[model samples]
Target: MRKNIMNRLPVILPVPAPPPPAHRAEPVLDLAVPVFNEEADLEPSVRRLHAHLRETFPYPFRITVADNASTDATPLIAARLAAELPEVEWIRLAEKGRGRALRAAWSASSAPVVGYLDVDLSTGLTALLPLVAPLLSGHSDLAIGTRLAPGARVVRGPKREAVSRCYNVLLRCTLSVGFSDAQCGFKAVRRDAAARLLPLVRDTGWFFDTELLVIAERAGLRIHEVPVDWVDDPDSRVDLLPTALADLRGIARVGLALARGALPSGRPSRSYAVPVTVMALAHLLLYAALRPAAAAQAVNALSLMACWVLAQPVLGRPPLPAPPALPALAARLAVTAGSLALLRHAAPGAGLRAELAVLAAAHLSLALPVAVARSARGGRRCRTGSAAS
Candidate 1:
């Protein structure tokens, strides 16, 4: 019986099976070093970065050299470094803007966290881990190494420092931006956040950082600031005046867009009582001041019109979803006329004091709800627009 069973199984033969597909781990970080024409600093900086990352970095990483239309030997040096280092890569772009290079490199990378630092490596490498850790752990959507932050140590001349401070102040006053430093080169963004933001950013030059931050803030994304020890690179090729002028132009454009409600925000709605009260007080004061000089009807009409004009940018136009522009204007005109009529009727026998009081109260009661509704609408629009984008 044993012999018969062995004969029955005689046709079976052992055949080799193919090996399973290899599982390759994705890189956790892609640090881009964008350069225009830094042939001399390219190799040394990359080698130093590679060494630092290799020694202390806790995860897999890659160093990308983004050469943006370099006329010298930068491309050659970058290629040589990429060839020498397994974790290094090079990308050559036809354009010359740091923003363009960074955008291209980051968009092409598959890493979960993509970041770029100045080729000069003016920022201390010790901050590298802190800069990316928030993004990796999902504690923040973006992280920036801020030289202006309180704990930061910065070494730069008086002129550069003054310029930096003044620029930031201008941003606060004009754009109402919350970020401390917008021009810092040491910045990182999660790939998902970058995908949503990069399309909305219009600047392809030095102002790119500011544009990115402004849009991100408007979209209600959380930004993490890391104080860094930084040394100014004396060999930097940036022209101060031209760059400043360009940045100002960019600011003006962005500010105008924001005023027109063209740029949307993602922040939650807040109590409108304070702003509404302030506007009401201001409006009352304006009417009182003009009451003695102008006719009652004139003063009332002017004050109401002035309030509407001033509030257009703050509360936004078409505060409610109503009819077309012509009809809206007509409705506003009618409302203003009715308000004046109501004021006249309320104080027909009383003095100017009584009339002004009645006028203020009536207008406040009517405008407060409108203002609140407008604010709420604006907030909703911001969230909706951000989501759609």
Candidate 2:
């Protein structure tokens, strides 16, 4: 009976599929576009970009457009482009934001060299070649098309130029950002870098580009800034004051992140002394508020504050060698000033209480390490080490 049953059943084993080939995958250059309500410029810009890509970049290429929940004919145009161009694909973003859309598109694309150019083609199609060249050649991990550099030419109105200069100056001074012009939208990165940056960044609005570049810089990646001919599109989406304020906030965030060593190095330090300097100035302001002639006293106080703040970092403790607590104190002061500054700017009188609170917090933050050190030394003196043991 067992032999008969075994013979009746046809033994079947599943066929094993071969493993994927071990050959290295070729890196494909993808031009990632974040398109919002760009219905008017959609076709023309895409055509121009396609033509440029065809003429230049003699490698595999694909265009990924993240259609940012456009309210106009932008989505329709993107769908049509995707259908017409084999190398083109559209990623629909439910929310609308230039930076957000671009990030979505880059993440969805399957190319190695990911890049984004303004929908208006402000940086010109000619600049695209150099933008992605560094990534392709393996010379640089990221490339940015800069408009304010020496060889770059900007054909915008005087107002735009003035605003751009002022905005950049503020960023440089506050964040100590090394980039000449961080706002230029035409930037590209290697697939690895793009993949790394897309998830690390949180801002999805106009400030996204700035955050991306800063993160890249902090990651110790070589960012090549390429000068290009940039003419401002009359229909630029940026609002003057609001956008300026937003960018300032972004700069501050980037600076704080950098100081905290949050991006790549992952080290902790209180090296942000600028905020302490600002706090010292605030103290001076408070003194002046009480007495007009107190400015001299305030100045002396500020000088003392500066010296104390500077000395801890520059001069290490003799007995114990460790990171200077100056950075830690400065960081605390900066945190306080930033909060107070925002409140003061947004709601002038409401920040007074906040200012007092922050000042107290700053003093505590600065004093803790010294207090701890002193306490430890006193405890050491009170005990005979081996005898206590």
Candidate 3:
């Protein structure tokens, strides 16, 4: 049997995320800081974050230092912080992927809300409240701190800025997504939403963040965006080329899934056999009523289009496909036109039975493969780690 990848936790983390912060009631929010080799910065960062949360946050909070296969003193630093602070805890994973670390930490969190922040703290801490407020108040399913949104301030090299803008634009143009930024490290989710979305997100690296947000949006969960003040971390370990290439591949994978209406919604997808039968029957009745050749052909075309729409499927909370996007809508129309044209120009003398046959043959052969799917809420693709999240 192909066992779930999430079960293969680093031996060091035989235990899950740290026990509820000792002495305090269970936290309302748990902040995950996923790290690899950051001995020089982890301790101070955690301390700084702890101080900020203690001073500003209204409710109890927990900080989990998720060290993913660090080869340096990072684990030691994280352990020390966990030992010294009542609100702090740490976990060590065997693998180095950030997505893997987050999966482990977030999956084990008990708080009503769970979120992650990069250890470098590139985004200012002030946005933290707005980030979680929506989830806490039951106004939003997820909250994100976006550098690309209006009123946000960002200081990054031109290259990074360009890449960020381009990547977001690609998401808008290809996926027709509403969120301005997909990979912002500063984000939080209501536990219930996370529980539903996590298992379906597939990427295990940087793309993990984007995948999670995409799934949340597609599932009809509300997302609140916070315009954050951010400063670029020069020491950031992310390699632009590899990350960008990976993101492109991720986009393509997701786009194809949306196009096929194959995104898993954590439910059993219904068979379309019934819808097709209904469509065929409806077309016959409509054509019988509108006997003029052009009108009868039009009726046949409309029924086929309706069948295509009803058959589009996406795995989601509603187990519904996104309304088709422009390309898809166009494709469906073109096919409908071609099908009607064929019956009119090629088989003008055909009887009613022959017309029905040709209509069915045209749609089965030409239209079903190409069209009807993915609205602005285009299906979000979930990958491996996320796929089993």
Candidate 4:
């Protein structure tokens, strides 16, 4: 019986001890300095960055020279630097956007913490460790060096200072973003957080930072801000006017998307039915009162503006972003104009009362959905704020 049992039993083979958790060494921090046509600045900036990290930073660090389609000797300098310094490496791209370069370098990094500052190193190197430490220690999902922070010391011309302040104010009014400085080039993020947020960030240009921060804030991520001593680089290559215009366009896109519930903040709870009805009635009454004294189009325009002004306070604490506002205004105007045209053609002898009634109905129809969507969004924000508190 024993012999038969042994013959039936299968031989137990030792499973080769699972390959000892492949001791893969990942850098603790990856600092990306993106450049475009910066042949003169590349070597000096990279070397200075390397020296600082080697002397002060107390972790495994790497300096990545992200060249954004520089049609100069920048690539050659970067290559030489990479070959010379074991801790430095170079990546070349066929595109020319700061955002594009950052996205590429950060996405490809195997490090736990990835960050970037402008090639000019406008932000002082002393702030580098603080910027990355929170992310590394898991205390925060992201960190930014803010020039506008209380303790920050900024040295720049009055024009640049004013522009920066105005831009931030615009962000607060338009997007309700809490971050003081959105355009600060010195910033860092954890790899895991970046993996989740990078895909949702659409702007591959100057507005990329603002879009990312706004989305992250809405998504309920903890952001750390470090007051940085930043000196404006006299040789800044940025074209302010073009960049500002692009940023405005970006704000519009992002704001509209947020208002329409296209992004991940979730649908708001409040209904706009009552508000819409009341506002529509008020708008119609206003149009009727003005019709006798003004042209149909002029009356419609005044009534529309009045409705917007009246609705603004009730909609929320701060006014809606320009993107959403512009569309709603456009829709109302289009409806009002179309209605006036059709009524004039169909009923050439239509009375003032009849015309006003028709125009009011048109305005109501267009404004109702917009009002409802915006009210609901406001409610969502309120709930979010309360919960956060």
On TM-score, the candidate that comes out on top is 4
State the lDDT of candidate 2 residue by residue for 1-389, as single tens digits.
Answer: 53454243222211111332466344387777777788889888888888788788688677777777666777667777877766666766667777877776676666878888877888877787777777888999989888788999889999989988877775665555678888887988887888888887878888898888777776678889899999899888778877865675566556555554566742233343333333333353443344334433343345445645544432342234545566654565465456556656776665334555555455556646755786687588778675677
- Over 245-322, each residue of candidate 3 has an lDDT whose tens digit, in order, gives 677667655655554555643322222322333334444445544556466546655654564454444211233443
How well does candidate 1 score on lDDT at residue 227? 97
Worst 10 residues of 4 by lDDT: 9-18
Candidate 3 local Cα displacement, residue 90, angstroms: 0.8
List candidate 2 stretches off by more than 4 Å: 1-27, 266-270, 274-389
Q: How well does model 2 score by local distance difference test?
A: 0.67
Question: Model 4: how far is 158 from its true place, Å?
Answer: 0.7
Clash pairs, candidate 1, are: none
- Two-way TM-score contest, 1 vs 2, winner: 1
Give each model's whole-structure lDDT: 0.77, 0.67, 0.73, 0.78
lDDT digits (tens) for residues 149-205 of candidate 1: 899999999999999998998677456678999998899999999999988888989
The best candidate by lDDT is 4
Evaluation by lDDT, superior candidate among 3 and 4: 4
When 2 and 3 are scored with TM-score, the better candidate is: 3
